[model samples]
Target: DLKMLYSAYAMEVLSDGHLNDDKLAALNQLRNIFGLAKYEAEAIITDVKARVFQTY
Candidate 1:
């Protein structure tokens, strides 16, 4: 649920089609909330979709 909020924020930042600092931070925080060990910027989106969206 929390990650969903964060992903929404991340998506807003990504709407411009660029990964800015805010988007990266949101992704990292979302990953942490999911108990993911750690992830680079590019991989966190996939993790969120795989781990959060599917189950919801």
Candidate 2:
């Protein structure tokens, strides 16, 4: 189950790597690819940014 989730998440990341798409569209694609049923890119990015900044 963990591996399956990770694979789905990896696919999401791959699909989102291109910045040509708007954030909403990219996040929706990610949500669909991951079977997440919802878009939460803002929250995720906020948490990730906080963590990254903390590391500095």
Q: List, in order, the clash count of every candidate structure.
A: 0, 0
Task: Give the CA lDDT, 0 to 100, for residue 48 in model 1.
Answer: 48
Best candidate according to TM-score: 1
What TM-score against the true fold does each predicted structure earn?
0.42, 0.37
The ten-residue window of minimal lDDT in model 1 covers 47-56
Candidate 2 TM-score, C-alpha based: 0.37
List, residue by residue over 3-55, the lDDT tens digit for candidate 1: 56655656555555565787677667666776655544345466544545444
Candidate 1: global Cα-lDDT? 0.58
Residue-by-residue lDDT tens digits, candidate 2, 8-39? 44444444343345644765665566555333
- On the 0 to 100 scale, the lDDT of residue 41 in model 2 is 45
